[model samples]
Target: MRDSAAGVLLGLACGDALGRPVEFQQTASIQRRHGRVTEMLANGAHGQPAGTITDDTKMALCIAQSLVESGSFDPDDVAGRFVEWYQSGPFDIGILTSTILRRLRNGDAWDEAGIDEWKHLPEGSNAGNGSVMRCAPYGIAFAGEPDALVTASRVSSAITHADPRCQWGCVILNATLAGLLAGEKQPLTSALELAADAPAELRTACEAVLSIMEGSESATDLELANSGYVVTTLQAGLYHGLTAESVEDAIVEAVMLGGDTDTIAAVAGAVAGARFGASELPDRWLRAIDETAEIRELGQQLDTMEISFPESIVEKLSSGQFDLQA
Candidate 1:
C-alpha cells in the first residue's frame, strides 16, 4: 500500500517531466522528431530543464501538500495554495484554471469563482482536465472511504472546474486510483460503479475503456482523443495506464498520443504507478525530476499518516449531502 501510494505521485512527476518537452505536439510530429519519447529532454515546450514539471505536477503538489498539512480535504487551503501558485505565474496553466485562479487571487471566494466562470462559459468551452490531473492525492488520503472520497473529489474539482464533467471526471479518476491503491481486481469497473451518476458522456467514455479492456474492442481501431476535454483525457489516460504492460510503456504511450501529452501521461502515470508501485518507475526518469524526493516524501506521508476529516464534512458525506452551490 505504501509503495503504491508513493508510486502514484512519483509516476505523476515522471510523466509530467517526460512529457514536458513534447506537449501540444501531434503524435506524428512526436514520432518524426523523437521516435518514441521514452527519455526526458529539455528546451522543448516550456524551455525548462529535462526533469522539470509544469502546472500539471505543480498543482498536484499543491493539493497533496494541502491534504497532508490539513489532514483532510480542505477547500479553502487548497484554493489558497492554488492562488499562491497562480501568482507565481506558472508557464503552462490551462485557460479555465488560470481564469478561476485569477478570480480567486482577486478575492473571489474559492467556491464562487469556478462556478461563476463555468456558468458563463459555453458547453464546449468548459470542462478541462486541470482538476483531474492533480486529483490523485485524494485517492490515497480517502482510499478506504468511498463516500467521502467521491464527495471530496467532486468538491475539490469544483474549486477550479465546476462543470459536471469535470467534477465527475475527478470523481471517477480518483475512485479508480483508490481502487488501484487497494489492489482491486477490476479497478476501472469499480470506479464506474462509483460514478454511476456521472454525466452520460463521461460514463460512456468509461464504458468504452472497459470494452477495450475486456477484449470486446480494439484500442487501435479507435482514434485516441488526447484533447483537453476532461472525458477524452480521462479515457486516454485510463486506457494507456491500464493496458500498458509497464509503467514506462504507459507514460511513453500517453505522451506519444499527442496534444495535452503531459496531463494525459500524468494521469496515466498515476494509475500505472499505483499498479506497479513507485519502485518500478524508471530510475533515469525519476532522477531527472528535482521534485522526485519531495514527491516520494509526500506520498509516504499521505500513505502512513492517519487521515482525518472534519466531523461536519464526515456527517455531510455520510448523509449524502453534496451541495456544490457555493
Candidate 2:
C-alpha cells in the first residue's frame, strides 16, 4: 500500500515534469524538436521551465490533500479546496475552469457557478481532460470497492466537469488503480471489465473505450482516443497501460501520443506507479522532480488512512474474482 501510494505521488510528479515542456506542441513539432521526447527536458516547446506542472498536477495535489484531510471523498470540501487553490493562483489553469472557480470563490453556490452560459461558451461545453488528470487519488483512496470508486469519481469530477466522457474517464482511472492495488497484471481490458458492472452511465463509457482499445494498433491508439475529457484521456492512458513495460515507458507513451499529453501521462503514470510501485520509478527522474518531500508526505498520509472497504472485498479483488471481459 505504501509503495502504491508513493508510486501514485511519484508518478504524478514525473508526468507533470515530463509533459510540462511539451504541453502544447503538436506531434510533428515535438518529433522535430525532441525526437519522441523520451527524456525529461528543462523546457517544453513553448520554453516553459522544466518541472513546471500545469493545472493538472496542481488540482491533483489538491484532491490528494482533500482526501488526506477528510479520510473519504467529499465533493463540497474538494470544491472548496479547488476554489482556494485557484485564488492562490497557479501558473496554468484552463480558461473555463478558471472562470468557474473564480465564481465559486466569490460566493457563487458551487452547483450554480459553472452552469451559466458565457458569451460564446455553451452551458455544458467542457470536454477537457481536467477531471481525469486529478482523478488518481480517487482510485487510490477508494482502492477496492467498485461502487465507492465510481461514486467518488463521479462526485469529484462533477465539481468541474459535467460531461459524460469526463465522468467515464474517472471511472476507468479509478478501476485501474483498484486493479493495480489488487496486484493484477493484465492489461486495461481486464480492469475495464471489472468495472463494467458500474453504474449505467459509466458502463457505457467503459464499453466505448473498450471498443476503441480493441481495434487500435500501438502506433495509432493514442490518436483514436481523444484526451479532452475523462473518457478519452482514460482511454489514452489505458492504451499506454496495455503496451508499456515500465513506468517510464508508460508515461513517455502517454505524452508522445500528443493532445493533452501532460494529463494523459499523469493518469497513466498513476496506474503504472500502482502496478510497479515507487521502486520501479527511474531513480534519475525521481531525483529531478520538484517538491519531492511534499509529494512523499502526501503519499504517506494517504497510506496511513484506513482502508474504507471491507476485508472480503479487498480479498476478492486481490484474488482476481472478476474475469477479463475483453
Candidate 3:
C-alpha cells in the first residue's frame, strides 16, 4: 500500500513534468517536433525548465499538503492553501479554476465560489478536468474508506468545479485509484460498481475503458479525444492508465494523445503508478521533476495517516446527498 501510494504521487509529477513541454500540441505537431516525448524537455508551452510541473501537479500538491497538515479532509484549510497557491500566480491555471480562485481570494467562501461560477456558465463549458487532476491524493488517504473517499472527492471538486459531471468525475477517478491501492483485480470496474449514481456520461467513460481492456473497443489515440472536458479526460486517462503494460508506457501514450497533455498524462500517471508501484516508474523521469521527493513523502504520509472525516461531511454522506453503491 505504501509503495503504491508513493507511486501515485511520483507518477503524477512525472507525467506533469514530462507533458508540460508539449501541452497543447496536436499529435501530429508533437510527433513532428519531438518524435516521441520520452524525455522532459524545456521551453515549450510554459517556457519553463525541463521537469517543471504546471497547475495540475501544483494544485494537487496543495491538496496533499493540506491533507498531511490537517490529517483529515478539512475543506476550509484546503481552500486557504489553494488561495495561497493562486496568489503565487501560476502560469497555467484553468479558466474556471482561475475565476473561482479569484473569488476565493476576494473572501468568497470556498464552497460558494465554485457554485456561483458554475451557475453562470453554459452546460458544455462548465465542467473541466481541473478538479479531477488534483484528486488522486484522496484515493490514497482514504483507500479502504469508500464513504469518506466519495464525500471527500465530491466536496473537494465542488470547491472549484461544481458541475455534477465534474464532481462525479473526481469520485470515479479516486475510487478507481483506491481500488488499485488496495490491490483489487479489477479496480476500474470496482470503481464503476461503487458509483451507482454517477452520471451516464461518466459511466459510459468507465465502460469504454472496460471494453478496451477486454479487446472489444478501439484503443487508438484518435478515439481518446484528448480534450479538457471532464468526461474526455477521464476516458483517456483511464484507458492508458489501466491498460498500459508499464508505468512509463502509460504516461508516454497519454502525452502522445496531445491536447491537454499534462493533465491527461497526470491522471493516467497516477493510476498507472498505483498499478505498477513507485519502483516501476522510470528513474530518469523521477529524477527530472523537482517535486518528486516531496510528492513521495506526502504519499507515504497519506498511506500511514488515520482518516477521520469532518462532522459536517459525515452528516452529508449519511443524509444520502452523495450516495454510492454499498
Give the per-residue lDDT digits (tens) of candidate 2, residues 211-275. Answer: 65466433443344534655567666765654578988998878887777887788778877887
TM-score of 2: 0.82
Across residues 240-308, which tens digit of lDDT does each residue of candidate 1 receive? 888899999999999998999999999999999999999999999988988888999999898888777
Runs in model 3 deviating more than 4 A are: 218-222, 316-326
lDDT of each: 0.89, 0.70, 0.89
lDDT of 3 at 109: 84
Q: Can you write out model 3's per-residue Cα lDDT over 1-326, one digit (the tens) per residue? A: 88899999888888888899999899999999999989989899989999999999988989998899888899888889988999998988999998888999999988677877888999888989999999999999988999888888988998999888888899899999999998887888888887878889889878988877877867662277888999999998998899899999999999999999999999999999999999999898888887788889999999998867888877765787543222
Off by over 4 Å in 2: 45-47, 114-124, 187-229, 307-326
For model 3, where is the 10-residue window of minimal lDDT?
317-326
- How close is every model to the real structure, measured as TM-score? 0.96, 0.82, 0.95
Model 2: residue 41 alpha-carbon error in angstroms? 1.8
